[model samples]
Target: MREARMSAIGKGLRRRGRLMAQAVSPPRRNPDADPGSGPAPDPSWTAPIAPRLVPSPVFVLSSVRSGSTLLRVLLNSHSRIRAPHEMHLRTLHVRLSRSFSADAMRELDLDRAELEHLLWDRVLHLELTRSGKDVIVDKTPPNTLIWPRLHRCWPDARFVLLLRHPGAVVASLTERRQDPNPAAVRAEVLDYAERLDEARTHLNPHVITYEDLTADPEGVTRGLCDRLGVDWEPAMLDYGAQDHGTFRPQLGDWSETIRSGRVRPARTATPGVELPPRLRELAKAWGYPEEDTPTP
Candidate 1:
């Protein structure tokens, strides 16, 4: 018994000594090891905790000039939904003032990305609270470019993929720019299209077309309301009757058509305007006719 007792005490002493050594000199990470070689951390890691203030918020993923502003106003007109002006949550960031700050945040199970997500959630929550709405929809077209980050932020978030004819989108953007370079304009639209395509491929989002939306606002909004688990209200069609913030730059389309307080017919693609090969292909994929030959 004495021998067993002595062995136990020695074992305990050795264990305590090892723990103290580890406490003094923690294990060093391999400096030369590839950080990305390991399996990526799950984007929904925080979902179990229900960390988001406004869970399952909606995002409209689209290229610029794709009628997202019109969609925003229609949804905002709903009693339960608040589709505000462009929040540009992507531009809002969390900066670590000191090197130790990141480490401190990590100790509390938050990295820089998570911190930004928290900030975004708080902003959405604040907006929703002020509007007294149960649902918040952010229709920032650029949000499609950073969808992976958004997925990490709010795993339960819903996406509304709004599509427009590539030709129409290119034309709209070209018209907006003061000194538009044709090549640059097409390239810019292509960039947005590619990101939007990537999002569509990965997410099972509700897809709507600008053409269809304008052609039948009631049918489109009813479908959206069904998806959002809300009753279809005719008030959604008369979006102008409700105050949907403002019609200004960086917010959304402030065009005369939007300000007209009614859904206008979507403009058709310009005649004989040949789309680039890539743009043509995307346009065809989106169910737009391969009407014009590829621009050389």
Candidate 2:
């Protein structure tokens, strides 16, 4: 009986010692948490916790291979910017239209347009609040082709056209070797650029040269901040140091953004395929010098 009682005392003392040890040692923090903050935010819940107005939502418009990812990394590094990778908003209407009904929408205090914005705003605001940022920059190149849809859904939204030399863009795409028909790929590139050129007619869209973004990231990003009505932070230039886990891939090519350090100059390449005649005209339209025939 005495031995049994002594064993009970021994177990209680061990339990109390463990409790005291745990109390003495600081609690381990979740790796996902921001230092000094309670917990890391879940991207899905931030919208309802702190609904953002999205008064000045930003879109990064560009043609594929225009160094859009590079621009995304730089701009997203800004203090107030929450630039997630492409959300593929090109078919936002087609997807939303299936469920759109006037009578049903009215019951929820929304019209057709409001319903679309409500659905989109939920996603955008969640992204912003999750990052604890004010500006939401959706970096989707195809979104430029659907300016009309965006303008209708968000009349106050802002745009940044990231332009690169069409020849450079074409060369980059061809090098990727993803698509077979170079001609078709060039047409898609020209189409996106032309749409932005036309979209400028009704909106005060800001243009940023991809060449400038790579060569002079700070100067160009600061100019973008001025246009965006937000203060520029040096942290933007330090994108290499930030966490990009929440960022999504765009058009299956966010791999370019895996660079670890500051921006680099445009990569020089000898493109073998000849650019179409229309591409030369577009080069001129976009302020890039025309190039000669493709090398055999």
Candidate 3:
């Protein structure tokens, strides 16, 4: 009698699990939906084996002011890695001048997005070839926003998730803006935090924290090197010795800290600053304290 009862419970549990999975699953695509009724879908949407020149390029996914530039310069110092300044690949778009231009490309099995992907791939390949480096890392912070598209573009791409304290990020942005709105600044940070969290959830990325990175540069970088399948080079710590291309606005952080050619310690959260409920929750989720504590 006990065995029969246990069997019934197991079946019930399996049924519940299936129902839960169905509830969270994405809605099925409408078979009758017009393809032309919307802005065309990505070319690689259904094609998982898309051709890419640089198949396993690395992307540092982080928010602005999150020390991505510092990471870039550090990685750039590596002999086998070519970490370029902000390559805003997402901003590069392919426009079909004539109405039939897209159709012509379509006949050749390419769409606008696919064309742009080809261009992006070619550019990365060119940079890698020019640098004579085996690996290329694009540390564009904005790339975090369009991660899904990037995944579609290069399915084999690797991701590095860089995180910072929410409160500290807000404080940094507020100080940097010429005329800062407290609410706006907080909202912006929250937006980035949400997206970063989403990307972290979806991608099996190598995660690093600005606090730990600054406190133990060698230790953090050594682990990163392991993840990137490279030997830990002492030169990565001496990023100041490398020529990381031009460091200007729009390209990346051109502050005195980055230009100083050293890893400065990350600042703690502002004492009196109050984070929004969501930001506070996210900060906690990232292992930050509720109080303004210095991160080690």
Candidate 4:
């Protein structure tokens, strides 16, 4: 019994000694670190770092099916330019702003300044991906509806407004049934066009018509480049081959057609496609000749 008691006491002493040694010794450094190294601090442990600032992107606003895609493709052909499909960033801002006005949304921590900063950060991140490019174009179609907000967001950023005959626009919309809500699309287009005109009075944005773009893409693009201070690139005309894999999937099969690298006239003389009379009248108002109107 005495021997067993002594053995227990010896084990206890060894354990106590180990405890004392552990308490006195400094903690071991990370095995991956050098012997003298201390804790490796996180690169972002100080604060959330903001992305490097870039110039605000040029915004193209226009009605759907109005050659905005063609312009975007053409502009993107320039080695110095990166044009992506309709990002609808301005629309997001509008929705966020509206959300903040609701009392129920008060607790969501959303506000104008926060939303603006968030959008700025998002845009900056996008710009960084196109780093080294001279210009980035946001080719959002519905962005035409929020021109004022876009102008306010980037006062110095250039705006390119694409004009199509409302008749052509309405005809295209009716044929494609692209707008799920026809009434809403009609109202939105009319309101957006009027608002665009109003905004131009104050902002003096560059306006290019679909007719001009289709007739002389290179010339119009050159002029646009001059106005926007970008160099004219022949690649813009052949931009159909460029990959647009990053655009949102909801954009439809149009991108696939654009990828085929064709810049045919917008109004093809397809046989047997009869356009309704109302659409013909609408097209006429927008300067499309009644006789040459492509069948729907």
Candidate 5:
């Protein structure tokens, strides 16, 4: 009778062990089970994690009428890039600095964190959204003069400098009747060119000659892409199809030139532009074609 009781006890223990295993283990489906009869939905169909945003900051520096717009259009063609017409933020910054009191200027220097916060949070954030780009490209020509400050603000920023024949730039500026200071523009161009050369020594900037860009846009643009560490997209060559709308009032008489999507050809420089002698000397030194003097 005792042996019989021991056997019954062992059997009960084994039964309990089996029940516990069934409770902890996942249910196995029958091979012939219905196709749609699953206990839980597959996890693969769930939504994925959000992607991180990219920060692209591209700047084009050049003199007015130096094919800066063309370059901007080309860059804007890139799917990942956003190249907008001159935001003139740097210009505004310069104007603001000039108008600020000495005490205010000191405060700006002392409050670097606050200043950066205002610039990035208030100004650049709005610009990025308005531009509709993963990367923002500022194509302000005069910004070339303030590159040192720009570099300080954005150390990792890349630069594209559009170079044109000094003579052609002078001729184009002179033809505008409303040019505030034609002579001053000429002087500024020369000075800026020199400054650009000097700044180049301090930064690894890419230079794109206007003539080369016009003649072989694809090759030049490809080269620029390589230098800028961006992929070369064919769309960039046909960016003129996009409309840029009306030019800004601050563009002055050059507004007409900006509206017209024409790239003027470089030819022999003509006289009567009244470029200062020093500027003329710099133009010659820069190897610009000789001016075509009209017969007296």
Candidate 6:
């Protein structure tokens, strides 16, 4: 099987790496016991010992609490789409690109961009194997903050921008009582919008509003399917009907709703938070009702 071959190849490479490390350096001692001594140096292990291949088919971009979880469940329900739980891949991007000087990049035999693509392939291949799906849709909202990096790594990657009223998104965050302050959330939304604009100039990202998704589930989802180039199955209609079983761990506040396997309308208010003027501006720009403007 392909999986077995990959597993065997990985183990063989690791074994060879250990042998090479032994050749270059003395046998390793436990770092804890040798506190005065430094750790063993395995410099050759820095670069990948195998050929690189990776693909990025889809990316779901959004602000926090922008109904991304619901959209993910809807898309993941489709026969061909596999929108997995949030991986916060922006962190992965950060780590892989964190220490790249031109010299270091050359030593690693991959520039930061190539490393990012290879990592996407590495992670997605494992994820696809587990989910038994053909396509990958990275659903982490923070990834929107790194749109340019994503574009550099996977220029052909399609985007789905999940838009929600800034008020509603802030309300949800406030309700959850997460560590992020309301001001911080607003600023993050503003930056996400800025990056969204930049991304639009390059890639045609499909925009899906949270209110519309809640108001007309089927119509919104069907349109989304058309944009994504996948046929809409009626089973995608009943979000709760499918049993995803006890696999695919959902992270963050999303875990609760996604675990329920259902779609619910957003509630209007949350405790101890009011709509700020900046968010109101954002809402207006996104064509949502401003604080003073009543719904038509």
Model 5: per-residue lDDT, tens digit, 68-123?
Answer: 77777777778767776566665343222222232353443423332442454245
lDDT per residue as tens, model 1, 1-296: 99999999999999999999999996876755443243334455452233889889999999998999999999999999999999999999997655456557666888777788889999999999999889999999999889888887788999999999888888888889999999988888999998888888899899999999999999999999999899989999998899987799988999888999899999877776667788787777778776633454
lDDT of 4 by residue, 1-296 (tens): 99999999999999999999999999875654443433333333222222324545687877776778778778877887877666656545424323224333234444454456467647755664765676788777777777776665565778887877665665566666654576655555566566556655677778888878888888999999998887787777877567755543445227455556777666643344355555455456545666656544
Task: Report RMSD (Å) for each prediction in the order shown.
Answer: 11.7, 14.1, 22.0, 11.7, 21.2, 12.7
Q: What lDDT tens digits, residue by residue, belong to model 3 across residues 231-270? A: 9899998999889888899999999999999899999887
For each candidate, what is the lDDT? 0.86, 0.71, 0.87, 0.65, 0.63, 0.69
- CA deviation > 4 Å runs, candidate 2: 1-52, 92-101, 106-114, 246-252, 268-273, 291-296
TM-score of 5: 0.63
Q: Candidate 3: where is the Cα deviation over 4 Å?
A: 1-49, 293-296
Winner of 1 and 4 under lDDT: 1
Question: Cα deviation in Å at residue 84, candidate 4?
Answer: 1.3
Clashes of 3: 0
Q: Identify the candidate with maximal lDDT.
A: 3
Q: Give the count of colliding residue pairs in each prediction.
A: 0, 0, 0, 4, 0, 0
Model 2 residue 200 CA deviation (Å) reads 3.2
| Model 2 TM-score relative to the real fold | 0.72
- TM-score, prediction 1: 0.82
Clashing pairs in 1: none
Regions of candidate 5 where Cα sits further than 4 Å from its true position: 1-56, 91-122, 130-132, 179-182, 251-268, 271-296
What is the Cα-based lDDT of residue 37 in candidate 4?
Answer: 30
Distance (Å) between predicted and true CA of 161, model 2?
0.7
Estimated TM-score for each candidate: 0.82, 0.72, 0.82, 0.63, 0.63, 0.69
Error at 72, model 6, angstroms: 0.8
